[model samples]
Structure formats: C-alpha cells, structure tokens
Target chain A: MKLLRNLVLAAVAVGGISAAYAAGAASFPHNLVSGIDAAGWDLSVRKADYDDDEHEGYRRFGGGHERHHEDDDDDQGRNYGQNGPGPAGSTTPPDNGLILKGTAPKVQVN
Target chain B: MKSFLAVLAVTTALSAVTPAIAGEVTLTTNLRNYGGPGAYLAYYVTDASGKYLGSLWMSGGKARYYEHLTGWYRATGGNLGEIAGITGASVGSGRTLEVTLDLADALFDAGYELHIDAAVEDYRDSPNEIVVPLTSDGSGQPVQGSRYIADFTYTR
Candidate 1:
C-alpha cells in the first residue's frame, strides 16, 4: 500500500510540472512572427500593392539562375511593414541587454 | 492519514502552478504632422522608481536608428533582442499607431508607468515623450506628448 501511494504522489508531481511548463510556453511565444495582418492590425491594402508578377523573383528563360527585374526595387521584395528588424541583409541585430524581455504586442498602423 | 497529506499536496501544487491573471490593454498613439520622414517610436514600461521593466512594442525596424529613441536606448542600450519579433514599420507623419497586448494585472494600479520615445529622421528626437501611469484611473484618458506624438491613451 505504501508503494502504491508513493507512485501516485510521484505521478501527480510529474503531471504538475508538465502542466506548468506547457502554460509557460503558451504564454510567451518566442518564435511567433506575425505580419501586419495580425489581429487588430490590418495592412492588407498596403501589402496587396506588391503582389504582382514583377515583384516575384523567378528563373529567367528557364535557366537555373534566378534574377530580379531591374524595376523590382519599388516593392523592396514586398517586405514593407513586415517582420524582422529591417530589410534582408541590412545589418545584424544588436546584442541583448539586461532589461527583461516581455510579451510581444499586436500592432495596427493607420 | 497519508491520503489526506496526498490531497493537500495536490491542492498546493495546483495553486502554485496557476499563472498570474492578465488582461488585454489597448494603446493608441497619434502623431502630429511633424512633416518629416516616418517616426520611430519605442513603447516600454517602467516602475514608479524608474526601473526598466520591458518593452511593449517598437515602431520602425532599423536597429541603427534605435539609438534615436534616447530613453529606451539609455535603459536597454539599444538591445535588439529587447524588441525582437515585436517591431514593425515606422509610423508616418499625422498617422496613428495602435497596439494591443495582454499585460499582467499586477502591472496596473501598482505604480507602474508606460513610456514612449519618439524620433524622426533629420528632426529632433523626443525621449520620454509621453509618460502615463498604468492605473485604472488613467485608462481611457488621452495624454498629450511633448514633441512628435500628438496624443497617447490606454484602454483596458
């Protein structure tokens, strides 16, 4: 009987630890990279302006090399108001500071 | 009996694992017609004693320009990780930026304050432009900024 009770207590403790870990992970999603279309922020009108064929980079003349058209700079690869610190290949992000990191906020720009 | 102790342990564990209660807060920032390039804004929180807590959001994604947000830069040393995955494009002149996030209930009515640092290209930088205490009484009340930002408000 004592052994059974010990096993039960151990199971309960493990379950509690697992539950806490899951809740903590759900609260802070470090990998969530939402776009301008996230909740409460809709920039679809701005993003739609760059969804044309010219904005897309593809293989020219069915060759192996992919090339962007000379006039493709207008959209800047359609990354306006999107994720990350800045445009691709701009610069590496700075180091982390001592300030505590918090949850990410959903944004809307009008 | 052993059964009673086991029950008590279960109850204690459950309560200990409970997460802090939180609520959604909506932050609105309206910019004045500064007539310059897009403005970079940093929205962060600090305690009553002026200790940096964390960042809510960062407008403008360029790390090089983050130093222009003087207040935040001084607090976090232009830490990109402080706003990683929480930044977006800069807000243009006369435009508005609205953000919503789930904040811990303890932050409100606990002597904490929300701050914004505004900067514009070729224009003067405004650090600590708007400093409003995060209290129930301050909610829904619009506060004017010193420079680029015209008005700022928070709603729970």
Candidate 2:
C-alpha cells in the first residue's frame, strides 16, 4: 500500500508540472502582446476600408497617435490641440527617437 | 520515461530561445518630394488571407489627420492605442521616417504582409501605399511606394 501511495504522488507531481508547462506555452502570444502594451503601444480592432464588411483584428498605434477633430472642441482641453507638442499640424521636423514597430509573429501549430 | 524527459528538455530549450528569436526590425520610409507638407503615414500588417492584423507605426501625431490613413483608421476606429509606443514625427517631402523594434520570429514565411498607407493635408489619401510580404527572403529588400512614399525597406 505504501508503494502504491508513492506512485500516485509521483504521478500527481508529474501531472502538475506538465500542466504548468502547457499553460506557459499557451501564453506566449499573450506575453508578447503584454510586452507591446508595456512599451506604450495601443492595440485595437477596427474595420478595413477596402473590405467594408470585414473587421480587422488588433492594430498597434503609437502613444501620441491621437487625432483631434473639428467637432472635438469640448474635448480639446483634455486632449492635445491641433498644434501642441505632438500636434497634427506642427511643422517641426520628425524627431529621431526610436519608435518600436512590427507585430508579434503569428504562431502556428502544424 | 526517456520520452518524457526529452519532451521536457525540448520544451525548456524552446521557451528559453523563443523570445530571443525576436530580432529588431527597422522600417525606413522615405517620402517622395511630393511638394506637400508632412505626410501622415500609417504602417500596419495583414495575415495570409489579406486580413488586417495590427498597426506597427503611425507617422503623424494628430488624430484628425488619422482619417487620411483610411484603411488603418477604418480598421482601428481611429484608435490611438494602436501606435502607442510606435508613434513618431511625420515625414516631410523628400525626408525619411524610420521605425525600429523587435519583431517576433513566427511572422515570417507564414503569408503575413506589411502595408503602408499615406496621406497629405490637402492631397488625396493613399491607402495601400506599399505592401510587402514578411519573409526571411524579403528582408532588406526595398520596395517603391505608390503615392507618398518614395521607398520602403525592412531589415534585421
């Protein structure tokens, strides 16, 4: 009986370890997305102009990518105006800051 | 028991190396001397079936001009988050905008594609300015753009 108990405990341990490994493996993409988010990138689901009926998945934009419209005067106080530090119409030269680009590589199981 | 050990070893090795496989990819877009003000450029990706994946970068900083990035603005509802850390200055005519970041290893040879959309303040909005496959072979290849972009290239 003691031998059988030891075997059962060993099996449980192995199972637990395997489950943890699988969980981590499955979370690779999520981790990638989180990394992107932590870097201050924005991800959203929007439509495609070419295919009006189709919806596109997550797209990452920069932190200062906000746009202020002519109708958004009320929100202008909170949001950046048309000519602020990172305004839409500023004639300032493009800053040479390092901008992260590209999406997480799509993973597939064959 | 041996098979299980081998599996564990392989998994451990893969986990350790997978993230490192993500190398930095830089995209340089040089706009033509279109005689316009700074151009609003939207850089994004798509899947094998041409489905919009996500945005990589946006050149212009403003939200209103984002609509000029028609395809991207439509797909993202003009969401600012898409280009959060990746936003930078707009490219002036004859100037270049460069974007660099770590790109995952899995996107290559999987029929994924990178696309750029461009618009000038008074000029017409140019969607799908440039489209290139994300592949190991295609890396470092420079492609010409349709309207605003004079050339585009990606490198490791």
Q: Which candidate number would show the highest lDDT if scored against the true structure?
A: 1
Listed per prediction, chain B TM-scores read 0.87, 0.86
lDDT of each residue in A19-108, candidate 2, tens digit only: 977888534477899999999988867776685523234222222233334543222122344432233222221322222222322211
lDDT of 1 by residue, B46-150 (tens): 989999988777887655567778899999987666666566777888989898776677888989888999877656778899999989999999999998999
Q: List the per-model TM-score of the A chain.
A: 0.29, 0.23
Among all candidates shown, the one with the greatest DockQ: 1
Poorest stretch of ten by lDDT in candidate 1 chain A: A71-80
Complex DockQ, candidate 2: 0.02
lDDT of 2 by residue, B37-112 (tens): 6777788888877777777666766666677688887888886655554555566788766666666666678888
Candidate 1 wrongly placed segments (more than 4 Å): A1-104, B1-20
What TM-score does structure 2 among the candidates reach? 0.55
lDDT at residue A86 of model 2 (Cα atoms): 36
Model 1 misses residue B105 by how many Å?
A: 0.9
Give the Å error, residue B64, model 2: 0.7
Q: Estimate, for each residue in A1-110, the C-alpha lDDT of model 1 and write its tens digit.
A: 99999999999999987898888853434334253336557534553465666636652321222344453321112232333354222422222221223444566878
The alpha-carbon deviation from the true structure for residue A19 of candidate 2, after best TM-score superposition, in angstroms, is 99
